[model samples]
Target chain A: MFQPEAGKTHLLNRMSIKIITYLSQAPASTDEICHTLAVKFQLTSDAAFLRNIDNTLHHFDALGLIKKVK
Target chain B: MTDKKEHKQAQIEQQLALKASEDSLSKNKRRRLLKGAVALPVIMTLHSGAALARTSNMIGDAPAVDAQVDMEGRLLCAHPDPTQPQIAGGPYDLGMMPSGHYEKQIDGNGPISLDNQAINCRAGGGVVISGVAYTSIMSRSGFNIM
Candidate 1:
């Protein structure tokens, strides 16, 4: 994704695309996103799925794409 | 010599000078033509070289795989050879999957313009999906596996 502010373009994987698209519609908690992705990806395990989603969420937090809602 | 003879000699010299001048003009014209002939190819060579450079830099560090973009600046899937060009299509809905193509992970902080769709992917390679950061940079380049 291209960040005009940063003047940089980021290349994303499929999973990232899913998360961004999901977030674009509305904000959701980490667990909500993790659950949605788990179903879509047909993930069998919860630990790895949650970890990946959490990591991605944290990364996005750093990027400021989404924020933690109170 | 007689005045008449002198006059005749002068006329002859004048004719010779005129002929020399004509010859000189023709030589100059030919020299100009030669220079132009040589310069034309050199100029063409320079232009083609620059064109090559721009093409190579078009994608910056992004892989040369065929990809497309939608009207809304969303990165779609790969083009099927002759059917679609790498940068063809309209705005693709965010949630919907574009066309079918292998999912290639492009990682780079390089600038990607919506105009040329020039993407620079240089970083780690994997299927990892990181979080989204807010930026004016609207489009992300990728192909849908569907």
Candidate 2:
């Protein structure tokens, strides 16, 4: 298992890469993604998780890795 | 058995690829059709459907915000969907925001009875005023004339 010794920004980038890979398969809403993440990572709090996913999506959108279906 | 599984996966992949292509085509067609449906001038003049109420370009004139001007041009006051989640203490609180509203041009190039005469639509034709994607040189953050 690869352990990340880097700080929050690096962790965020790695998480965003995972997000982009998942989204490459199909478009998903923030809620749907957070639920999946929470289940996979065993995290809690859907609403707060949504905010993090939303922010990451915003960055991905700016980078043109994904586009809003709507 | 492994070969059979690979073939099955290939078939599913083919189907997914076909579906994705169909979706992309449909979205493109819808966007093109929507472009044609709205009046070209309205499309050009106003870009911000909601944030357009703040027309800082007009010197003394209050921005004309009917927000919901009917393309059918009917005089109907469209009340935004009540169930739609709104920004609390914002436009929703005022009951002034529309679900969607076209931005109106702030001024014309004619000598009008307004305090600041610099901005007007009298001389320009088809020159886009509203819905500008570029940052205004005269805006306050850059420059606020109004």
Candidate 3:
């Protein structure tokens, strides 16, 4: 995916694709996204996995792909 | 009997091969998926100048907090747990020491001897500021204090 604001291109893997897809549908917190993705992908939803999702969300926020809700 | 032994050996070999293949495939697939998922910012920026400028200017201004007064009585409980009520004796103040100085005292306690290491809020020892007794929630030798 190409981010025009950052002038950078990203290779979206299956997990990232799922994250963006979920965010596109509705606004959700880190825990909400983690839980939803865990159930969808049959993942363990451990701390490390949750941290990965948080990092991805932060990256998207930096690129202006997603906005943090007040 | 010879034929029976040969049949059993073939069955065992086939099962081992099947298990090995399944393990290798699953391990490889999971490893690749997780690697790509966690390792982000994979590609190069098309416009380095713009990206660099944006990054450089991300933080417009940062107000200095060292000079600010910590009026919250946070000194009483450094890491307050919501479940536990605030330390008694309200209207706490930082006393004569400036906020920055007080913060430093709390942050760095040169070298806490083993005797001082046992002194903590739970142990009933506290610091007195402006004649108000406030239990320092953290331990002097604990990792929390830098």
Candidate 4:
């Protein structure tokens, strides 16, 4: 009775891969991850933009992809 | 009799091998699904943001110090030193010392030492000269030095 959606595939870009990979390596506070992204990838000027990435992490967590240790 | 036994054993081995392969395949699929679930949206956002910022120079321009301050503030707030009392109306002067007499002796003796020249052999009695330096600094600032 359970059916997975057919022909649906999730794709991630390189930068996202990089960010997630970094996060997976260690449990970092959201701000720390955002700083790393900004410094390493030159992502955005607004520090508040980090909140968007935090939201993304929450999404990943909901999917059982990542977890918040702290 | 040997042939029949061998055939039965082979069938058993084949069944085990098939089950093992199926299990491994299912595990791989589950792992891939998990990875996709976690990685996909993050990647999408990064890609989209990059694409949008490609036309402008403002991408990832956040000041480094601001980031450092944010990180430091987060760490400080999470596990602050218990000994450091919280104070109001200014930066918590962690370096400030309380208004009291602290004694340091050049010689290892009680309150008094008899011979001044013997001070070399025995620890000398050097009182805190005075808290003049500290008092001046505290009085001038008008801040609690505790």
Candidate 5:
């Protein structure tokens, strides 16, 4: 079995919390999440930010936190 | 008595050979007839009828059928009715018949007018936005105008 790095888990946990909070209110697209993360979290529109969001979402999916309906 | 048995066996072998030759000739004749143009259309017609019967049987055994049109006047996915509409919104809105609905908005083309106001509809509970600019460069040009 492969395990995530300690730093990676910590970063994912923070992003997952924010995403769950937003998604709980209403369903949003990936673009919507990106925009919200930029405005609320002050995350810049950089490759790192985008990659982090994507990886965190994938982790959440593996954990069954959210599902893709369409 | 041994000679009599051997004679009967020889007669049976000759008869079998003659029957086999007749069978082979009949098969050849049938093959020639099948290769002719007259036989082609007859065989094709029978095949078509058989295919139609098979398709009809399959359609009869299907669970259910339903259809709907999208915002672009195109047919969307097929699903059971009363479940959800395949597409809904704009000029296609027939008002709540247990079907889905789309919100209206200005498109990313031309000038914003009532006629140009495109509706966003949901197909089977998923939102569908039409005439929106995609991520491609050509679509980005259209988005820039918006």
Candidate 6:
């Protein structure tokens, strides 16, 4: 969950849900999803931002929401 | 004496050149023989190693058990030996069970799939359907039973 430089709350949970929905259709790697999210939100695709997405992906993996495709 | 010395030197040079030519041919043959000697054992070793690995992974006289379902047709039985090398990286090795393996309670339905059979057993208790044992992760709600 990245805090946007504004008054709006960081919707990490909502993004997690969206990520789950995206993964439900097809298996995607962390990098693929991170790049897509970065493009969709117009966020800078830096290490920190990618790390946040990877964290969410890992959380979903732990919960069995998404599986890492070989 | 100078002429004789020069003739002797030329004769020596001719013999040296002839010996060099013969040695080149023999060197090529020796190199080929060495390559054959080294490559034969290396290839044989790799081939034998692969065959041995295959044989080691084989489950000799493994039980021929078939997948069975309960009378209600809502259960899946396990037949594969978990300890077998053949099944090490198989589907059951990981979470072969679907997410619905533990759904706690059936939601407003008369028709549920075979995968949701564990839902009837609630939490804290495991359900063994058709010889397949399913251990619940959550005591009330949630998933993964294999």
Best by DockQ: 4
Provide TM-scores for the models.
Answer: 0.33, 0.27, 0.31, 0.27, 0.27, 0.28
Give the per-residue lDDT of model 2 (tens digit) for B98-123: 22222232337642222221122212
Judge candidate 2 at residue A70 and give its lDDT: 33
Q: Find the 10 residues in a row with the least total lDDT in model 5 chain A.
A: A1-10
Give the DockQ (2 decimals) of all models: 0.01, 0.02, 0.04, 0.04, 0.01, 0.01
What TM-score number comes out for model 1?
A: 0.33
Candidate 2 has a TM-score of 0.27
Off-target runs (Cα >4 Å) in candidate 6 are: A1-12, B1-146
CAPRI tier for the interface of model 6: incorrect
User: How do the residues B1-146 of candidate 3 rate in per-residue lDDT, one tens digit apiece?
Assistant: 69999999999999999999999999999999999976643321122222222211010111122111235322221222233222244212222221112232233656433233223322442222221122121121121321
Task: Please identify which of the two predictions, 1 or 3, would achieve the higher TM-score against the true structure.
Answer: 1
What are the Cα lDDT values of the candidates? Answer: 0.45, 0.40, 0.46, 0.40, 0.40, 0.43
- Model 4 has an lDDT value of 0.40
Of the pair 1 and 5, which is ahead by TM-score?
1
| The 10-residue segment with the lowest total lDDT in model 5 chain B | B55-64
TM-score, B chain alone, candidates in order: 0.30, 0.27, 0.28, 0.28, 0.26, 0.32
Segments of candidate 1 deviating more than 4 angstroms = B1-146
Tens digit per residue, CA lDDT, model 4, B19-107: 99999999999999999976643322221221121110011111222211111121001111224432232112222332222212233
Q: Candidate 3's error at B124, in angstroms? A: 86
* Candidate closer to the true structure by DockQ (higher is better), 2 or 5: 2
Give the number of the best model, judged by TM-score.
1
Model 4 chain B weakest lDDT span, ten residues long: B53-62
The numbered model that scores best in lDDT is 3
Model 4: how far is B65 from its true place, Å?
61
